[model samples]
Target: MPKFAANLSLMYNEYEFLDRFAAAARDGFTAVEFLFPYGFIAGEIKARLRDSELTQVLFNCPPGDWAAGERGIASLPGREEEFKRSIERALGYAQVLGNTRLHVMAGLLQYGQDRGRHLEVYLHNLAYAAQQAAAHGVTVLIEPINTRDMPGYLLNTQEEAHAICREVGAPNLKVQFDLYHCQIVEGDVAMTMRRDIAGIGHMQIAGVPERNEPDTGELHYPYLFGLMDELGYDGWVGCEYRPKAGTSEGLGWFRKVMSNKY
Candidate 1:
């Protein structure tokens, strides 16, 4: 089985953010990921991870003004400075938490906005972020979010994200391939994973259509898990899904898969 990392951002909502680390650890998760750690001091989160004996695998850079409806500012024009600041802030947290991966969310595009301009800005920002992150031995990730859930999200396809990585020309910059989003935008999730595994820094999974637990949706996750093992993907597979019921109660699929591996 691929190494599974519980995504505290979407899972384990039953507990407070700080408490989710121990909750995930208690449930047999050796690694964990979250959306942002900016809300809490880095030391606070680091302590939780140490106490729980869990590894921090991934977390996103600041998505500017998340409460104000901003998904990210990396691809937005006129926010280059803020985007750079977000990367700096995220790197600080990553260093403290001992996480090597930092996801950079491409903010949404507004009505009638020029996508060409946004792409230019995004490429430049990613290059800068990657260069800075490399010095700390951290990898920068860009995820292709499905527009269905995030209508205006700037990045929406694996091809697009990979192309952006190529344009950025930074070795540390890679794709955060979310299988759930890939299924929505482009259906051949397995083939995409096999073909692009080299450029992929991390991955996330959820059931398609409902974005629920992997076992409850259209995607056949068992096969995908096997495929990850076959393809020699050594990165952490983030369980970024909304539990159909309670987080712990809905982990039967995870338990079964892990048992099979053992």
Candidate 2:
């Protein structure tokens, strides 16, 4: 069976942020990841992880001014300086938390922006991020978020993500294959995985259409997981999904498919 990491930011919404570490550990998840850990100090987050004996497999780089509706600044023009600073800051957290991968979100395109110029900035930023992450023994990931949940998102398909990874030509740069996004943007999840699993660094799962638990999704995760097993994928799969009930109560399918992720 594949290793799984609970997405504290999404799954344990009922608990306080600090409490979610223990909550996830109590629920039998030894590995966990989240959207961002910028609000808390590195020592504080590291201490929580140590106390719970949890391994944080992944987290995203700081997306500038999340409150002001800026999802990320990596691809935005005139934001390269901020993105570089965020990369350094993220590397510090990863070193402290023992996180191996960090996702660099490509900010959405605004009205009147040039697509060609945007891609240039994005690839440039990604190449830089990948270099920095590699120095810290961390791999940088780029995810293709679906247009439905996040319209105008710069990268929104697995094929495009795979191609970008190739274009960047960085050994440390890889794709974050989010099944929920892939199912919506592209239907052939299993086939996509088979084609470019080598370029994939991390994975996430959520239900289709509603973004709920995987059990209700149209995609047969069992079959996809079987394919992953066949391909010898040993990476931690982030459980980035909303619960229909209490987080623990809605973990029936997760627990059933889980194995010794140690």
The deviation in Å at residue 66 for candidate 1 is 0.8
Query: Please, what are the lDDT tens digits per residue for candidate 1 over residues 107-191?
Result: 9999999999999999999999999999999999999999889999999999989999998899999999999999999999999
**TM-scores, all models, native as reference:** 0.98, 0.97
Q: What is the C-alpha RMSD of each candidate to the true structure, in Å?
A: 1.1, 1.9
Best by lDDT: 1
Question: What C-alpha lDDT, on a 0 to 100 scale, does residue 140 get in candidate 2?
Answer: 93
lDDT scores of the candidates, listed in order: 0.94, 0.91
Which 10 successive residues of model 2 have the least lDDT summed? Answer: 253-262
Decoy 2 TM-score against native? 0.97
> Which model scores highest in TM-score?
1
lDDT at position 139, candidate 2: 95
What is candidate 2's lDDT per residue for 1-262, written digit by digit as tens?
A: 8888999999988999999999999999999999999999989999999999999899999999988888888889899999999999999999999999999999989877898898999999999999888888899999999988888888998888889889999999999999999999988889889998899999899888788988886888888888889999999999999998899999888777865321
